[model samples]
Target: MSVVTGCASCGDERAAGAAFCESCGRTLATGTPPAAGADCPACGTTDAVGADGYCGHCGRLVVRPRDHAETAVATVAAAVTDRGLRHHRNEDAMWLAARDADVDAVVCDGVSASFDPDIASEVAVEAAGRVLASGVPADSPGGLAARVGAAIAVAGAAVAALASTGDPRRAASNPACTIVAACVRGREIGYGWVGDSRAYWIPDEGDAEQLTEDDSWAAHAIGLGIDPRAAAVDPRAHAITAWLGADAGPVEPHTATLRPEQPGLLVLCSDGLWNYLSDPVEFAATVRGAVRKESDLLRAARALTALANERGGADNITVVLVPIN
Candidate 1:
C-alpha cells in the first residue's frame, strides 16, 4: 500500500512514503484512514455503516475492494439549464458510465430546442455504450467512425419508431442533439462526434485541445477571418447546422484514434461549458487542475461545472472527464 506523504515546510509532495523528502529534507504528513461505521461502498451513504453490507443511504450492496484497480471508479456529473437568463426548463442532458475499467465511456448532450431532445440524447449515449461493449471494429483506419455512424443511424431509426406513438411534439417537432463518445479498448482509443459537442485531449499540464468543431454560423464566420471571440459570442450562437435526429441525414461522426504518448486527461463537453471559458490557457489550466481536486472523475467534472456557474453560469453546463493512468 502507498502512504500519503507531503512536506511539512511547504506542504509539497515529498517521497511518497518517506517521513521527509530526500531533496528538501521537509517532513511529510501521513494519510487518514476511513473511520469505523463509515459510509457503505455501494449505492451511496452518509449515515452509519449498516449491518447488512447494504448502503444505509441507498440500500445498494457494498463491497470494498482489496486492489487499487478494482477500486478505480469512473463517474460523471452534469448541470443543465434553459437559456441562462431565460427559459423555464433545462433540455440539455449528459451522463458518464465507465462500464469496464475505462474500456468504454459515453457522453451525450441533448438539444433543448428540439421536440424530445432530451430523450434522443439519452438514447444516443446508451446506444454508444452498447455498441462499444459489443466489440466494435477498430482495425481499419476509419472503421471506428463508420461503426459509430452506423450505430447512430440505428438509434435514429429507433427514435423514429418512438415518434410514431403520435405525440405531436415528439412526432413533428424534430428532436435532435450532439454527442462526443470515447471507447478505450486496451490502449487504443476510439472517439467520434458530430456537431459542436467536443472531445478534448489534455495530456498532463498541457493545453486543452478541442477535437471537434461546431457546425454553426459563428464557426463559419471564424473560418472566414471574423474574430473567433467576437463571432462566438454574438447572440446568434444557438444556431446549429448539424446534429442527430430522425430527419437528420445519415450520421457520419468525426472519428479518430487517440493514444496519449504521455499520461493525461480527456474531456467531452457541450458548447455550453466551453462558451464561458474566455481564455484558452485558463480554460485548460482549470480543467487540468480538476484532476487533482477530486478522488473520482465524476466529482472533478462536477467541480468544473460549479466553477463555470460561479463565473456566471450563462448557459447549460455539461462535462465528462476521463483520466488516462
Candidate 2:
C-alpha cells in the first residue's frame, strides 16, 4: 500500500514519494523522512498531529475553504466573505437567494471565544437562509416580521444544538454565533438580528439608517443615558449581550420592518465591515461609491471586501448587498 501523508502547506493528503502535492501543486519533501516524533504544526505538541492534517492537540486546520468567497444573483444581489489578515481562518458565513422581485439573505459571524465557532456560523446562516427562502405566503397573517423572527429562532436553535454532541469541548464553550437576516419582497423589507451584526437601509438621495438595534454592551449603556463616546470607548462596548448558543439563554431576536419610498440599497454585514464604518451615512456612501465604480453587484461586493482588508482587517469580514428598485 502506498503510504499517504498530508501536505503541510495546504493540508491535502499526498501519496508518499510523490514529487508534488496533487491538491496545491507544491513541491513535496519526499526524500527527507518525517522525524520519529514530529511536533504538531499549530500547537507544537510532540507526535500529536493527525493524518488528516488537523492538530490533535489544538484541532487547528492547515487551511480551509471559504478563506474568500463570493456569490451573486444576476445583478440584483451579491455577497462576499473573507478570512481577513488577522484571523487564522474565516469564521463568517453568508447566504443569498433571489427570485424575481424577492430576495432572502443571511449573515453570521462566529464568536471567536467559542470552540468550532466556524461551524456555528455556517449552520446558523444555512438554517436562517432556508427559512427566509421558504416562500412564506404573501397574505400570511403574521406577516414578514413574524417570518423574520422565526428564521432567527431556527438559526439560534441550530447553533445551540452544536453543544448536544459528544464533544466535551463543544459543551464547554458551546459553539456560538451572531446572525442578521433580511428578506425583500417588492418595495418592502423585513430584517432581524441577534448580537452586533447589522442591517442598514441606504437610500439613493437621502439619509441612511440602521434598521436593527445592536444587542451589545455599548448600545445598552447608551440606552441607560451614558454618553455615546464614553460607552463606545469601554472595552466591553462591542461585547455582545445576546447570541445564538446553548448558554445564550432565550434568543429574543430584534426585528423590524421597512417600506422605502425611494430606490435604495439594503446592506447586511458583520462587524468586520462596520467596525471601520459604523456611521450609517459613511457606510451608505462607501457602498454607493463601490456600486457606482464597479457597476456590478459582484464586483461591488468585492470592492467593499477589499476596502475592509486595506483598512486592516482585524476580523473576518462579510458583506451582502441587495438593490431595492
Candidate 3:
C-alpha cells in the first residue's frame, strides 16, 4: 500500500502515516479541501509564512507584541509605545516606575538609519531606568542631577557595547539611539538627555516649559542666528548631532534641575509625539485636556498616541507621563 506524504489542501508535509495535516487539520484523504495555506491574513501564499511573524510572500508584518505596549504604576505614572501607522516595527522604548512619592522615567528613540535601532533603544531605557530607580544617597554630592547624568552615561555605554567584530550588521552601521530621562522627588525634578528625545514640564495654571535642548541641526542653526522657522524647514533640520553608539565620541549629556512651584505633569517623550505638537503651550493644553477628559493617566497616554496616529504617524511613538503633585 502506498502512503500519502503531503496535504493537498495546505501544501504542508504530512507526518508518517498521519491521518490529517497538522498545519491546517486537513484530511490526508480529503473528499474536498478548503484552501491552500490561507492562514496568512496579508497574503494567501501557500505555506509562505516566516518564523518572524511576517508574510514571507508579501513581506508584511504579522503584528507582534512589540507593536504596541503600555504600563502604569497606580495613578502616579503611565507610559505607552506604538509602532505607528507607517513603520513596520516599533523602534521606540520607554520605562516608568514610582517609589513612594518619587518617580523615575526614561524614554529612548531609535535612530532609524542605524542597524538594530530598536535593540539600542531597549538597552538604553533599561540601563537608565535601573540607575534612576536605585536612587542617590541623601548625602551624595551634586544631588539628583549627578545621578541623572550617571544614568545617561551608563545607558550610552550599554548602547556602545552592542557593536562588535562578529556581526557584520553591527560592524557596518552599529546600533544607536537617543535618550531622555527624568527623576522627580518632592518639588524638584532632575533630568538629562543625550539626543533629541525631550522632557517637558506642564503646569496646571502657569506656562509650560521644554526642559531639554535638542542636539540637532535645527537647534544649532537657530542658535547661530538663523530664524527658527527657516531652520525647521531645512532638510537637515532633524539630523541629530549627538547619539549613543560605538561610533559616537565623548557623549556629554545635557543636565538640568527644575523646582516647579505648582503641580502639573512631567512628560518624557520621543520625537514622534513632539513632531506633531512642538509648541510648549499647545502641547501642554493638549496633554492637560486629554488628562481632564480621560481622567486616567494610561488612557490619556493612549489618547495622545492616537492623536499622533491620526495626524499621519510617520514614525514610532513613545510617551511617558508622571503626575506631579
* lDDT, each prediction: 0.57, 0.81, 0.81
How many clashing pairs per prediction, in order? Answer: 0, 0, 0
Residues 1-325 of candidate 3 have per-residue lDDT tens digits of: 0113564334566533465445533223211122334456666666765555566688776655577877676577888888889988789987665655677788899999999999999889778866776646633887788888999999999999999747889978989999998878888888999889999999988899999899999999999999999999999999999999988999999988888888989999999999999888899999999999999998999999999999999989999898889
lDDT per residue (tens digit) for residues 1-325 in model 1: 1123443223456456664444433223222232446666454466655554456677564422100001123332222222222223234444333434444445555667778766676567556545554555666546665555555555556554556667887877777777777765545567877677777777785556776677777877888899977886788755777777766767666677777677666677776678776455666787877767775664566677667667676655566666666
Candidate 2 on 248-294: residue-level lDDT in tens? Answer: 99878988889999999999999999999988888989999999999
**True-structure lDDT of candidate 3:** 0.81
Query: Estimated TM-score per prediction?
Result: 0.67, 0.82, 0.84
Residue 212 in candidate 1, Cα distance off native in Å: 1.0
* Superior by lDDT: candidate 1 or candidate 2: 2
Worst 10 residues of 2 by lDDT: 25-34
Error of 2 at 54 (Å): 9.8
Over all chains combined, what TM-score does candidate 3 have? Answer: 0.84
Q: Least accurate stretch of 10 residues (summed lDDT) in model 3?
A: 26-35
The parts of candidate 1 lying over 4 Å away from their true place are 1-90, 95-100, 140-143, 160-162
